[model samples]
Target: MKIGNLIRLVIFGLLLVFLIQPELFAGFFGLFTKNNQPAIYNQGSLLDITLNHLGIVAAATLASTIIAVGLAIVVTRPFGAEFLPLSRSLANIGQTFPPVAVLALAVPMLGFGTAPTLVALFLYGLLPIFENTLTGLTNLPPAVTDAAKGVGMSGWQRLIKVELPLALPVILAGVRLSVVISLATATIGSTVAARTLGEVIIAGLLSSNTAFVLQGGLIVGVLAVLIYDALSALERFLMKRTGQLGRA
Candidate 1:
């Protein structure tokens, strides 16, 4: 494997070890504490919290991807072109408001759990995916699209067989951005009673436990890095495959 890939693998392996047995690193982190107490966050299982955190992010990203991509596709179509401005504005609404504020507003309706977090994340993730999808679909080479139409392909056929395939890489790029941002943002979900890595950080903050804060931050950071690398690899693979198919 290439040196960079090998380094990522090693970092990911160590992240797994840290997540699985965080207590093992207590001694190391304890050195930074004032009293040098054990650097453990025992309020809940790190594994379970990590899993829940990932679940929330995945769910939100999936929902966002579906809705955003659908909107993008619709706006790019001849029949729906007039809706482009409206769609863009709607997608922009999410980032216009702070996620924490959204969470606060949603809590009254959703009653403080995964729902509010999901809503917030879904909204926050929308803009990038939508914009990228729009860019991908709208920026297609006119010649290629014309060729598809010349071959007697219907609009739908041209879209599915020509446009979408060519646009997959760019769409995936947006998805990668959304997912990585969501992964970090999901920690904030804990403030609204969602189970997430933020629980550890919050607990640490409440009791002035540096170890707890560090542990939580470490997990989130490592997880983000791992997922980012994985998604980047996926995007590269898709782009390569799309290129090969185009040549064929």
Candidate 2:
């Protein structure tokens, strides 16, 4: 493997180790602590908090992908073309309102915990996926789509067999962007009592313990980078398979 690839693997391995056995690094973290404070966050298990964080992000990202991709597909269809503006506006709502504002609005209706957080993340993550999917579907080579129709494929068949396949790399790019954003944004969920790595950072901040903040930030940062790299690899693979690598 290339040196870059090898380094990423090594970093990923360390991340897994850190999550699973954070206590093992207590000595390292101790350097950042003062006044006899605990180095590792003892209020919660790093592994559990990390898992919950991942779960929330995964759920929100999945929902965003499904809804965004579906909306993009609808808008791209001739019958639904007129609604493109509406769809764009709807997706833009998430971007227009900040996640914290969404959380504030949702908390009264959804209550605290995961529900409000999910709503915030779901809305926050919509634009990238929706816009990318729309761009991908709208920018397809007319010749390729026309050939599919010329071969006697129905509209649905053409979309399913030809258009979607060609557009997947682009769609995946959007999903990747959303996922990375969600990973970082989800940290704020802890402000409303949601279980997330934000708890660690918040605790650190409240107690003036830099160790906790660094630990939480480091884990989230590493996770975002690793996930981004993995998705980029997938996008490149798909582009290569579709003979669009050169274009990329």
Candidate 3:
């Protein structure tokens, strides 16, 4: 009912309509084309391309979340505390180099297509999730953890029932950042022969078709905004539910 929600709804609706029936906007895109060049990207369906793009990002983010969160959990444990620096360094590796550089390196070993792109995205997404999770776990209120211990909760039980739940909102914040970054970065995967919205943008670039470029960029941009907004809402909800809203 709020203005911001209304705007998000309208944008999401338009994105759906565009993906479902892109031709309806041909005239609009045509304004950017020259010499009667085709306006829509006909090489692949916009809906299919968008779905593929989301799939790749989702897969990579999921993998990144599992590994990063696991590493954070391990490093926070007493026995694993000494490994914190090493874990941090490992997570930092993916982001230490530009994504393009990672892709270039991956291509030789993984071959072209989705494998290399997934690797690049997975590695690039790790640092944020790992850092956020680590921060969240380490910053827990000592009294709360002490209370859990006093209640006869085993270390594992305390972590499962007390720590992770409280830390989840912070972890989700990192996931949100990683997901948004992956959405934009995944577009570049097309250069490695992966099926993605980047195909439209690359084609437009090669042909000097501004329309194609605009269409592709618009879709990706809108998707990033929408997903970011959605994840932020979820983060706020979790923070409130976990009594961390005031801190936020």
Which candidate tops lDDT?
Answer: 3
Relative to the true structure, how large is the alpha-carbon lDDT of every model?
0.90, 0.94, 0.96
Using all chains and alpha carbons, the TM-scores for the candidates as numbered come to: 0.95, 0.99, 0.99
RMSD of 2: 0.7
Clash-forming residue pairs, model 2:
none
The pairs that clash in candidate 3 are: none
Q: What lDDT tens digits, residue by residue, belong to model 2 across residues 105-153? A: 9999989899999998999888999999988998888899989988999
Candidate 1 lDDT at 134 equals 93
Report the Cα lDDT for residue 104, model 3. 97
Q: Once model 1 is optimally superposed onto the true structure by TM-score, how far is the C-alpha of residue 54 displaced, in angstroms?
A: 0.6
User: Model 3 over residues 1-248: C-alpha lDDT tens digits?
Assistant: 99999999999999999999999999999999998899998888999999999999999999999999999999999999999999999999988988899999999999999999999999999999999999999999899999999989999998999999999999999999999999999999999999999999999999999999999999999999999999999999999999899976
Which lDDT value does model 2 have at 2? 98
Candidate number with the higher lDDT (1 or 3): 3
